[model samples]
Target: MTPAARLSAAIEVLADLEVRRRPVNDALRDWGQTHRFAGSKDRAALASIVYDALRRRASSIFLLGADSPRAVVLGMLRLGRGLEADDIARLFSGERFAPDALTDDERARLEAPIPDMPAASAGDFPEWLTESLERTFGDDLIAEMQALADRAPVDIRANTLKTTREALVSALAHLSPEPTSHAEAGLRFHAGDDGRGPALQVEPEFIQGLYEIQDEGSQLAALLSLAAPGEQVVDLCAGAGGKTLALAAQMDNRGQIFATDIDARRLAAIHERLSRSGVRNVQVRVPRGRFDPVRNPQVADPLADIAGTVDLVLVDAPCTGVGTWRRNPDAKWRLRPGALVERLADQATVLDRAAALVKPGGRIAYVTCSLLPEENDDAVSGFLERHADFESVAPSNVVEAAGLPHLAEFATPGGGLLLSPRRTDTDGFYVAILRNRAA
Candidate 1:
């Protein structure tokens, strides 16, 4: 399909999403099913336009002075793709399969000087999050959130259990992979102009489990846990076992890792991943029966026997996923105030469970793929308040223990490392280490 035609299709898809409030992937898939004639390239191009529009949704609306899907796509062409006014005019020529001709108002708006916008509009994020983000980032809020509004590079971690980083990098040389700045095992691959990366899943090295597609920040989070060999660990929220596999590798297949999640469905893919990565130290513990800690406090848990004996407990707690906006821009717009409250509650519950599993002198690594202070610093503060026996590990000490002294600069006021796209060239992640002081 022509570029104009693709833009037209993207506008339709965005309109559907705005009305139905469904996921972008779902809406795109439905559009594809209906438009069977659209080729793979055409579909991919359409999706790219739609995603770019979403990535700069707030800014696009502010620039165009309208919120319609057509205005969004048109605004994205100028803002995201950096197209000139005449270039956009050619595409919106009202030809068949092309968008309607640009109105006189659109022409004037597109050619006008960009007006100063508020932080939320400038950064293309939810307006409700401005206060929290301002507190987290202070003066650099726009730069930080704008970085998140851009596309994300595809990152893959060399599975140390199967091969070394050097070896994996050589095997995937065709993809032009580069080593990540912070993560020793990470390799980064730039996405194409269409906002898609190489299909690493089908690569021979990937099929052989030489690497796993993990964000650099996520790899750093797992590494910071410092899950040493022969140390008993509990991956409290081991969804899909991404970090669980990383921990098993760090343990060199010596110590045991009790990997489990509240939702069995989330754990389903873990077994296959563990088998592929050649991880032997992880024990998959699926919930046996109905077990809601709040509803039935006495219900048996998978890790009940190992309570108060674990050397480390990794709480990769769930949050609003604001950090992943570079990859999931639609989520930022879809996020509501109620969702943050629910996540805060979930983080508290999981941290409490992780505290129960940590032995004396053991460590609990509290992690969130969120930039919100409510989920990061505030959550850790609340945990420290509830468990006086557990003290927040100093930023210097935590980074030293992880052998990543360079990260000490990203230390938060509440005592955690904050990694972000602008600051760390990675997805936003917050990690804090707490040590059990009571013997």
Candidate 2:
């Protein structure tokens, strides 16, 4: 398909997403299913345009002076795809299968220089999140949010249980992988201008379980768990075992990791991943039916036998994922205050559960892929208030122990560490290490 046609399709998909309020992937998939003529490249290109448009949705709307899908596409061409006026006009020339010719007003907006925008619009984030963003970054809010608006580089963690970082880097040499600045086991890859990164998944090394696609921030969060060998650890919300596998490697597959999630469907994928990564120390646990998996009493509790004996409990709690904007930019637009509230509740629940499993003097590493203070600092503060037995530990100490001493500067004022796109050149992740008081 022509580039213009691809843009047209993207506009349609964006409109569908706006109207249906469905996920971007679901909208794109439905579009592809209906338009069978669009090949793989065309679908991918359309998806990219739609995603880029969403990433800069507020800025695009503000510049174009309209909220229509066509206006968004036009603005995205200027901002995200970096197309000149002539370039955008060419794509919208009303030629065969192209978008309708741009109106004089549209052309003028396309050619005009961008005006100084308000903090929320300038940062391409929700207006309601301005306070939260400010709370998180203070005077640096614009820079920090703008960093999130930018495209994310692909990062993968070498499965040290299967292969060393050096070995995986050699195996995927053509991709020009570089060691991540903070994550010792991580390698970074730059996605091309077209948003296409190397097909590392199809590589023989990946098939043989040499590496797993994980963000550097995520790898560092898992490392902050400080799961050493022969220590009992529980990945309380181990979705797909990304961190669980990392913990297994840290333990050198010696200690047991009770990997469980509330949703069994999410837990299903972890089994296959555990097998592929050669992680043996992790035991999968799930509660029966649609119930609270962590605290369910009727079902067999895999963690029951190890409760109060666990040295570490990693709570990769569910959140609004404000930190993952670079990858899931569309989600930011969909996020609501209600959703944030729900995630806060979930974080509290998971942290409380973790507190139960942790032995005296044992630690709970509360982690979230959220930049919102409500989910990070506020949640931790609330947890500490509720659980008198637990006290906050300096996250800098955890970073130092994890051998990323250089990252000590990223710790929050409350002793938790916040890794952000602007500050750490990684995803927005918050990690707080809290230790239980000894009996």
Candidate 3:
């Protein structure tokens, strides 16, 4: 398809998303089903346009003086794809299968120099988050949030249980894999101009479980748990067992990792992943009846046999996922105020659950892929206040012991670590380690 046609398709998909309030993938799928003539390249291009437009949605709307789908696409052409006015004019020339000719206002807005926008508008984040972003990032809020609006780098961690990072790097040398700045087992892949990364899943090494796709920040979160050989660790809310597998490798197959989640369907994939990665130390514990509210509540406790014996309990708690904007930009726009409140409640519940499983002198690594202070430091602080037996452990010590001392710069005053695209060149992640004192 011509670039103009792809832009039109993206506008359609964006409109569908706005009206239906459905996920980007669902909207794109519906578009593909209706437009059977669109080839793989055309679909890919359209999807890229839609995602890029969402990434700069706020700034695009501000610059174009309208919030219409066409305005976003037009503004994104200049702002995100770096196309000139002449280039955009060629596409929106009212030709067949192309968008309508630019109106006088659009043309004027296009030609006008970009005006200084509010920080939230410039960063493409919600206006409500301005204060929180300010509190979290201080003077670097714009820089940090703007970085999140860009594409995320593809990151993969070598499965130390199956193969070494050196060996995996040699096997995937064709992808120009570079060692991650901080994650010892992680390799980074920058996206191409087309906004697509290497398809490592099809590689023989990947199929053989030599590596798993994980963000550098996530890898560091698992490391902060400090799970070691012969220790008993419980990965509370271990969706798909990504970190559970990481903990297994860290323990050198000597410790026990009880990976449990409220929803068993999420654990279904972990069994295959564990088998693929040859991880023997992890036990995928599933609650009976899976995710049904009534059934889930009544299900037998999967970890009943191991409570209070855990050396470490890692609560990779769910949250608003603001840190993953680079990968799922549309989600940023879809997020509502109610969702943040809900996630805060879930984080507190998961942290409390982790506290119950940790033995005296054991630790809990509370983690979230959220940059919001309310979900990160505030959540940890509230939990500490509620449980007098648990006290904060300086995350700087964890970073230093993990041999990533440079990350100490992100240590919070309340004794947690915050990682962001600007600060750590990684997805937004917050990790706080808490130790349980003996009674």
All candidates' TM-scores?
0.98, 0.96, 0.97
lDDT of each: 0.91, 0.88, 0.88
Error of 3 at 317 (Å): 0.2
Q: Which 10 successive residues of model 1 have the least lDDT summed?
A: 289-298
Per-candidate clashes come to: 0, 0, 0
**Is 2 or 3 the stronger prediction by TM-score?**
3
Identify the leading candidate in terms of TM-score. 1
Residue pair clashes in candidate 1: none
What candidate 3 gets wrong by more than 4 Å, as runs, is 290-297
Per-residue lDDT, model 2, residue 256, is 84
TM-score-based ranking:
1, 3, 2
User: lDDT value for candidate 3?
Assistant: 0.88
**Which of candidates 1 and 3 is the stronger one according to lDDT?**
1
Candidates' RMSD to native: 1.0, 1.6, 1.6
Candidate 2 residues lying further than 4 Å off, grouped into runs, are 293-301
Tens-digit per-residue lDDT, 137-198, candidate 3: 88888889899999889999999988888988888899999999988999999977677889
